[model samples]
Target chain A: MIRIEDLDFSYGRDGFRLTVPKLEVAAGEKVAWIGPSGSGKTTLLNLTAGIVSPDHGRIVVSGEELSALGDARRRDFRVRRIGMVFQEFELLDYLDVLDNILLPYRINDSLTLGPEVIERARALAEGVEIGDKLHRDVQKLSRGEQQRVALCRAVLTGPDVILADEPTGNLDPSNKERVLDILFRYADEHEATLVMVTHDRDLLPRFERVLDFDELCTPAPAPAQEARA
Target chain B: MSDSLYLAWRYMRHHKLKTAILIGSVTLILYLPLALQVLVDRATEQLSARARSTPLIVGARGSAVELALSTLYFESRSPAPIRMAEVERIRATGLAAPIPMHVRFRVRNQRIVGTTLDYFDFRGLRVGRGRPLAKLGECVLGAAAAAALQAGPGDRVNSSSEALFDLAGVYPLRMRVVGVLERTHGPDDEAVFVDIKTAWIIEGLGHGHQDLASVGAEGRVLERKDGRIVANASVVQYTEITAENEDSFHFHGDRSGFPLTAILALPPDDKSKTLLLGRYLGRDETSQVLEPVAVMEELVGTVARVRSWVIAAVVLVTLATALTMVLVFWLSLRLRRRELETMARIGCSRRTVASLVVCEIAVVFAFSVVLAGALTGVTSLYGPSLIRGLIL
Candidate 1:
């Protein structure tokens, strides 16, 4: 579902640079990327999702070359085919849980928010154990509940690939396990690829394969680590 | 677009105070100038309507504007008093009918208008209740005056004294409210109408006292000679003109020499009006004849000039408020930069994101417009009465 070869990316002049010689993950694969901070794990996710373009490389996700697509088409592909969860649970504070879950349909015209889609979003919220809090403001929820809401948003569109950047980084151990259970369950049910980046090595055993970030990205000429995603 | 509007509405709902503040600022910007215009237009209409109806005003040689104001509105202090002889002079001209006016006293906050019954006929005033001013001390209340004083027929109202400490000031005369005039929505609505003689009595020009020739007058009489009895200050004077003392109330001086504030001269035709106006234009004329319409127009012109200045000032204020509002919105956008970036990264196009912000502003503007329009409509409906209350 994802392939990258000869990927060269940098922040700017004399900044942190990342080089990926070769990487591939098969469809329906559940992979966890274990890395230190600033090891280019999140950067690889962004490139694969077409959120950022590589300076010199080819990126293929779900048989589509992300680097070849224009900005608008790439964005369309990302919303339609890939679901993304962030470390911060980027949900709008003004909206309730349901609106945050249905945000993809509202922000982009590629998807229509029909009654069926609403039903699906409700089902996803219910599956994440947040059905009762659908009308509550996201700010009023605990960190675990907020991450559950983000997971519902990512899976509501039923994308082919789920890219989560440390989705359980802010959760307690119990909430961390709950979030992973939901993420893994959705990927298994839909045969969707799951690429998660995390600092915790204890959670690596659940994935089909684990990739070390240092082995994937060559050492930068300068000593400073990359802070951007 | 509806989606964008929905999100915008949610954002506005979350920040209620900010939304309300924006609406209030915009509403004031739209309402101030509009309300001022409505009030000024109503004032102009009211001033012109009364002035246009009254063809001419004859008064003592002083400010024509003051004479018109006093004669027409019963507002402002009375100008120099013209003699009752001026009404006779206008009558002698054979070109117009004269209605003498005396507006010098007050019954509480209401003005006391002393004129012949012809003034009522000329001004289209009707007695809404009870009877007209038939007796020497009987008075009629205007509709608003009756409401303000809470008096009706058979009720007595004493004129307010000019000065409480001045021993020589006119004594308060208790006059009976014989009737009330129908509301005309003009200056007459706030006046207490009485006969010219009743106003003179209020001024102490006419008075009634005990009969010194009577059998009980022996102690009060200072002299009794040649069939004439002179009384001392101990003799009782009537403060109220009752039926018993009505016959004794008499003027001390010649009636023609009595004071009048102004005369409403009604000419039958344009030729008669021109002749009467020509009669008062002499270089030595002690009294001035003025076309009230002309004087009111001048006053309105001055008000219009001031209106422009006021509107200019409001516009400047509105501009400053608009700039401040823009700054507020710009700062809000800066604060929401992260939210906006999330929307864009989540696949909202630049246009869609911009549309959301625009929708928020549009809703605020729409609410302000509706509020301002409603306020202006209310002002248009009641502005004339408000101006009348203020001016009178």
Candidate 2:
């Protein structure tokens, strides 16, 4: 579960501030954030993942307040409790697909996922149809394949929460549906919370809940016909 | 840890040019200091060895350093010649065994030494060829000198100018190459040996034609039979002195007028050396006896200070280079900010990234140390022959 109340963030002095009010998601919930450009959807996802801290409000993930923890402790908390799927895929080119999926466990030694973790990862890869590409370099994969690899890596550790920012932005329509199906199915089966941000309306009905960030953020100007008199 | 090492190795292998440049700079920095240290150490060893072997060097009262360098090291300008009388005075004391050395000539650019047969015994020289210099005009060559001139026993070689360029005063005196000395690993390896009378003959002091009619009526008929007058001829060539003219090489004037450059003395014991030194110190003027080893020790003491300072500077520079290399590597890591950030979001830690950078540097430095050490070892083994070739 996660909670954000009146969170305001800024890049620098005199820069625009992103404001979010009263956002909450429960355990095993699958939610998609739909917004136009400049709606601060990615910024909210970053704050939830503890990659950025809120300037004016609090954020809680898996019942732990990320804003109260120091930088080092926050990094440990993120590694142990949350998995992130970046928009750019963000895979290390030097590592193969298997190592990239196994990286979270390697970093946080306290997380004792046994041989069953590898089995779960292999099953997840097969479910995503990337089981044949396990030993291949991540760079050699196509955009759709890379997105599926990112999705599998996100839920590989069975973290309490998964934050995906524009996960299928670069994929075609059919691959986009397939990626979303695998992501939502895995989150529901493992009882893990999923928060995805996207502007794609065709796949919006697949999620259990949808939060329209246009209403959560500052309202845009009226349309041209309404303003023209 | 293994994973980190694997990542480090993969990164270096992918960036081959950058890795090579880093390793190359380290190799050059380490090579310079190590090579200089080895050369200076070897030079100091050679200097000390020369000093400990030669007991006392007797020469004209001028530059003691130049005298020791010339007589012991075969370097520097020739000193003013001393007299046979001075040699006899030291020899008659019975406190020391004196060996006279007349080193005012050279054979084909190699120094020609004129000393007694006892010289070879004292120096522990072994003949690799025929025999020692037993008779007048019979010469022995060092192994290097023989190889350089392409001469062996039964061949003959002539002396060049005694001074730097005294072509008008050139006296062509041929010497029979009687023996070749085995390699001694000292200054003797670059010299040729002959009896003392040969040195006098090469210097135009004995048995040399000098205007026969101007000398005496007896000398005139001998010059006419040779079809030339010594003063009129541009060059004077003297034949080898045999048993017929062995006594003719002696000085016509007082024995003190004969030219002798330096006398190497082997004192009987510590007490006699003290007495001999006291006797020389008691003199009024014109000559001084000195212990070569003592003066050399003083010289080496002065050299050691400068050497230590230079070595310290080299060490500091090497350390600075290493620190700079580390800094460059750190800066390079920082330059890959976006790449590293991507790795971090995926799962690598700040610690793993740091380990990767350290591993790359360790590989570069380890390879450089090995290469520099091998280069130093090869240079040390071949450096002596290379120096001999350049000098000789």
Interface DockQ of each model = 0.61, 0.23
Q: Write the per-residue lDDT of candidate 2 for residues A106-145, one digit (tens) a residue.
A: 5544455468888887888888888999999898999888
For candidate 2, give the DockQ: 0.23
| Residue A103, model 2: Cα distance from true site in angstroms | 5.9
Q: Which residue runs of candidate 2 sit more than 4 Å off their true CA positions?
A: A1-16, A22-38, A55-211, A217-229, B1-42, B83-87, B102-261, B282-285, B308-327, B353-392
The residue-level lDDT of candidate 2 at B180 comes to 95
Best model per DockQ: 1
TM-scores, one per candidate:
0.90, 0.68
Q: Which digits, one per residue and each the tens of the lDDT, describe model 1 over residues B46-75?
A: 888999999999999999999999999999
Error of 2 at A106 (Å): 6.6
- Residue B175 of model 1, lDDT score: 92
Expressed as tens digits, the lDDT of each residue in B1-392 for candidate 2 is 55566667766776788888888889979887787667556655666777788888888899887788778866667888888888788888988888888887788789888888888888899999998877777889999899888899999898886465665574768888989999987778888988887787777666643334444545334345455533444433346665655544444466566877788888978898888888877556576778988877776676667678977998898899889887878787886677677656644567767776777777888999999999888767655445423322
